[model samples]
Target: MGVSSGGPGTGLLDRRVERGAVDRVLDRARAGNSAVLVVHGEPGIGKTVVLDYAVRRASASDLRVVRASGVESELELAYAALHQLCVPFIGPRLEQLPRPQRAALAVAFGLREGPAPDRFLVGLAVLSLLAAAAEDQPLACVVDDAQWLDRASVQCLVFAARRLLAEPIALIFAVRGPGGDPRGVRQLRALPDP
Candidate 1:
């Protein structure tokens, strides 16, 4: 994170590596490819600044950006953060999903009464929903404060991220805090940097 001159995070200084990685992901999305990036750092390190930069750039390129931030108070609530990220597509988009996926999402979001849906179905539904949303335009999902996200939401997002293929979508996450999931963070850290 660098000092902000304040416009779409363009003012950020000394962040070429971070910015380049973000640009590559956006470029891939523009080319109808799927990409995922996880921004992890201690608090106050400009993770948000980089996210803002990605949002601005993606928007400029006509990508539909959906954003969500984990709430500490809602950590106990299953699917809370995932719900925020999916809210934009829940209406018409939900109809595009397969019957099983639609039903799973409906139950997960508490829109219907049913037994707990299968976990794999929920993750697949999210992936299907996002892929469908990108049919008209590339999609960008920005999730900040991921360390505080509910376990279920994190698992679903991670599953979706790992399964993305040929969809014009970008999934980015910003995770902070020492109390976060060490295993998840370590796996993300293992991902190639740039």
Candidate 2:
């Protein structure tokens, strides 16, 4: 699950996937610019499948991959995206946050607070730091169901994407449009073309 899809291209469905967009993204990623890929379409339009294929292809090329999903139930927490980035490493040394903030986040997500901003920041910071630390490898942050992202998490991700432009990191947000957030679409369009 950490490496290549070990198939012909991105994967089975990739044969039918939009190669131009995917190739453009890969080409730019190889050039050291992080991409904010938004796969927007009607519901059940296979956005996730396309992104999965892209990610698998990227992993085959030795890119480091991190995956997360936004949930409708927890849309107000400041770091839902961050938590998705950190879940694989949840454990000790992560429980040190201010109770109010922790409880608010925990209750929203139905998870116990580890600590105040410490745990939350750990995932967010670590992802960025990993990009900074790896000079030869590309970092891929695959965020699924992005339309469900809370305001805070969405803003944080936008900020993170801007910072990753200075590093070897690429972001792929699988979004469902029409009913999705217009602001998110506009924000992504505003990113400097790299």
Candidate 3:
């Protein structure tokens, strides 16, 4: 019937396996568990369509869905995709982070002026921001075209994805081609499959 119920998705062509994986990830998050999945394939092979399926299922299940698609032009801009993904959770939820994490994100997002924030701290800030968002409801993040994400943003996302545990969060990403964003796609691929 829905992601909450682990039901099959509709209207996808020859993609039952992918849809099921997406549903299972969402189901885990709905059950107060952390889940992540990376969907990668060649261009025009329905990677974005699969991501869209996950987003629609998440919305239908009432999970708080936040989304961003990586843009080629923004690849050089630090944390550009991350800024898009975190916009919804950035305000009051940001205040909940440890001071160091707060400052790191503030500087990363250009909200504050300072020396470049440590990548490690910025990653922790991202994790904290997302976990806090999930406190109110399960959070589903749909990041499409991940191959185009800035290196800085990809690094932070990889860190956050790996650290998720016992949290109602689902981090789903779709990338085009054999691989996308070397640092992000490679690290994400390295995660214990599932």
Candidate 4:
């Protein structure tokens, strides 16, 4: 089977079945509602493809998109995934964060020196940063291969995902599954090709 361009009559096998879910996420962001979508499937089952589609659609709709892929080799490094997601948003607005939150993120990113940060504090800081960015435009945070994320980054992301109410943000995680489900996030399972 070949991947389609997510359009009709293109003589391609579009991921029509998955489009609705992606649309719902985009719709929610456009309406200033926060949403978290977890796309789970085994390796080679198009989880990355679906994420790519969502990224394209989001960009076309003018949403600010940030993406991070968990590297198995970096699993032992603290805050690596979270740092990747924050890089684009890490300018002067970061200074607007509460002092503690700012310090925590700076320390995590190695942009400052400090004792270890509280994990929950780092999560809240991230949520605040994303919310601030979305104030100018809707924002989408996409993560692929989430199962390989460091424990610290995963904990922070999961905390932010659970508490994203009333923000114009969408959090999408695509994980290789049949295992490795992140608790408390909505799951969108990709159906196998017939």
Q: Cα-based RMSD of the predictions, in order?
A: 4.2, 7.8, 5.5, 2.2
Poorest 10 consecutive residues of model 2 by lDDT?
Answer: 185-194
User: Candidate 3: misplaced stretches above 4 Å?
Assistant: 1-11, 180-194
Give every collision pair in model 3: none
Comparing candidate 3 with candidate 4, which one achieves the higher lDDT? 4
Residues 1-194 of candidate 2 have per-residue lDDT tens digits of 22333354544342233444665676677777766667666667667766777677678777777788888887776677666764543432134344453354454344764544443443345444445544657777778888888776675566556555556666777776644443432222211112
Worst 10 residues of 3 by lDDT: 184-193
Top-TM-score structure, candidate number: 4
Candidate 3, 25: how far from true, in Å? 0.7
Models 1 onward score TM values of 0.87, 0.64, 0.86, 0.92
Clashes of each: 0, 7, 0, 0
Candidate 4 lDDT by residue in tens digits, 13-59: 56676767887988898899998888888888888888988898899
Best by lDDT: 4
lDDT of 2: 0.59
Candidate 3 lDDT by residue in tens digits, 94-178:
8888999999999999999999999999999999899888999999999999889999999999888888899999989888765
Q: State the displacement of the C-alpha of residue 69, model 1, in Å, after optimal TM-score superposition.
A: 0.7
Q: What is the per-residue lDDT of model 1 for residues 94-193, given as tens digits with 9 covering 90 to 100?
A: 8878999999999999999899888799999999989888998999999988888998998898888878889999887887843344332222331222
Query: Any runs in candidate 2 off by more than 4 Å, and if so which?
Result: 1-17, 87-127, 179-194
**What stretches of model 4 exceed 4 Å from their correct place?**
1-5, 8-12, 179-184
